[model samples]
Target: MKNIYILSIGKVYRKSNNLYFIDKDKNKRVIPIEGINAIYIMNKVSLTSNAIQMILNKGVPVHFFKEDSKIGTFYYLGSLLPKQKKPSGKVHIEQVKAYINVEKRSEIALEIVDAIRYNMIKVIEKYREVYDYTKTLRNLDVRKEFEQKMTDWKDATNVIRGIESNIWVIFYEALDKILKTYKLERRTRRPPKNEANTILSFSNALLYATVLNEIYKTHLDPTVGFLHEPYEKGRFSLVLDLAEPFKPIISCRILIWLINQGIVKPEYFKKDLMGVMLNENGKRVVIKEFESRIRETIKIKGKGRKSMLIFIRKQAYNLEKALVEDTKFKAFRLVY
Candidate 1:
């Protein structure tokens, strides 16, 4: 993924033939948009119409992130304009038909939830030796939830979310033992009240955005989802659904690794009227670490070993297979 990251307050415009990044200090940096997959605007960055046109002409998407959370995406006109956009092919059509049929939707939703549950259990079990999680592991009812079934999209979604909530509760509890500095009483969103919550939310948002980027490269529609309903507006519900199994297995591990490596300190966070958040330096550190984490290689069945980015794209392809060929979509499970 050839991604250009912009983190500072700057003005971006199209010069003679390249994109120029001019900082508040009037210092300019040239970024050739050639071979670039996406441009990530992480902070307050101004863009010119010509620059926008240049990006569209290159068929590159621009993703805007609010603070540390991803707000929305600006896909190229060719991607958004129905008349210009190509069909998603037969498999994607079948996937949409399944969405129209509630029974199939419920089945896929259950499979997604099942994958999420299995991964959560695997993550917790792997960390059991590192932390005394006997009580937490005993309280987790993975078997009962695995055997459970749902009737409709709403029911399946509710159960899936509820199970996910419980998993995080226990997962955070176990982490609190190792990461004593950043205490997570419970999972918090919007204004993350604590350092742990702030790190988790930011990195999780990155995970969501990465999934969306992969979906853009595939034939799958980012809006049409199973466990999550496709919102009429900008919400990428499919990314949210697919990102579930990955957040615990990837983002959580990266956060813990950062803490253990002393790369992240408590002073990196700040609290204001908006709530607790990573400072500028903190954002740089976390973003750097997150980027490195995605590039790290992992072993997979049949594919041998590959970087997490490729793994993500392959997972998206697996979903396409599941939708098109009526095959089971096996979510990634991190092996310790």
Candidate 2:
């Protein structure tokens, strides 16, 4: 698993042989080259030719952000994130073709919802004994009302909540027995103060945002998603579409794992005057764990293939293609 290294700690400068890390004030620090998947230069992080050569040889992509935080330069291994400045008009036409299959899109959207719901059922099944969820899903005339409900899924909270509650029930009996020490509970959208949910949401957004940004680099456009609604303000709903079933299993497991392993203790974070924020040491713990979890393998069903961290972006790209081509969209199911 590779890492998207955040040069947030300090100025990143290139040294001989490998990339060297330096602080803002002026202190040389050595960086471990083994774990980096990509490097993000959020600001004016510097690198030398020798250092660039080493990073390039390792096939690490380097990204530079402008003052406004818009992505400015993309450094592919030895090159940049890629500038398809002259995309073939024919390819562009094909991309459009993939994006505009109306009839196929409707079927794909339904299948994608089914797949997401199916995986969601697994999340529920983990907690409760299977009673008659088949009937519940069968009654879901969401298909007929998708056009409207997609706009206001806040109404569907009752349904999503029902499913979430069913999932928690199964764990309820076992959780208290196993997690007696950490005092665990099934958390919903908002996590309690002094808990790790803030870090999880922040990390998840960072992860999903990066993947969505990268998916755009491919021939696939970010619009025309199946599960999520397309609204204003550059809403990359497609990424969220893919991220739906993932949040509980991936991030939830990460939170539990970090707690059980003592990587992050309750003391690592504090509810400040503003809100819950991880202290310096706590940020390091979560940042590292989030990157590691991103790289962790989650067996994806239907594809019959094993996926790593980067495969997430690839899957999102595949979903975009599936949606555009009117093929059935297979949601990424996380096998626990």
- Cα deviation at 197, candidate 1, in Å, is 0.6
After TM-score superposition, what is the CA distance of residue 203 in candidate 1 from its true location, in Å? Answer: 0.7
For model 2, what is the error of residue 82's alpha carbon versus the real structure, in angstroms, after optimal superposition?
4.2
Predicted candidate 2 versus true structure: per-residue lDDT over 1-336, tens digit per residue: 344455454655566555677767777767666666566554456666667667666656565533211111111122244344435454345444543554444444455555545554454444333334533543554455455444454444334334434444543333333332454444322333335545555455546545654554465555545445445345565566566556644555566567667666777766644445555566567667776777666666445455445556666666656544645556555554
Which parts of model 1 are misplaced by more than 4 Å?
Answer: 13-20, 26-32, 48-50, 68-85, 89-92, 121-154, 231-234
Q: What is the lDDT of every predicted structure here?
A: 0.71, 0.52
Residue 206, model 1: Cα distance from true site in angstroms = 1.3
**Which digits, one per residue and each the tens of the lDDT, describe model 1 over residues 133-173?**
54555555643663464455456556666766676666677
Candidate 1 lDDT for residue 246: 83
Candidate that scores best on lDDT? 1
Residue 307, candidate 2: alpha-carbon lDDT: 48
Write down the TM-score of every candidate: 0.81, 0.63
Clashing residue pairs in candidate 1 are none
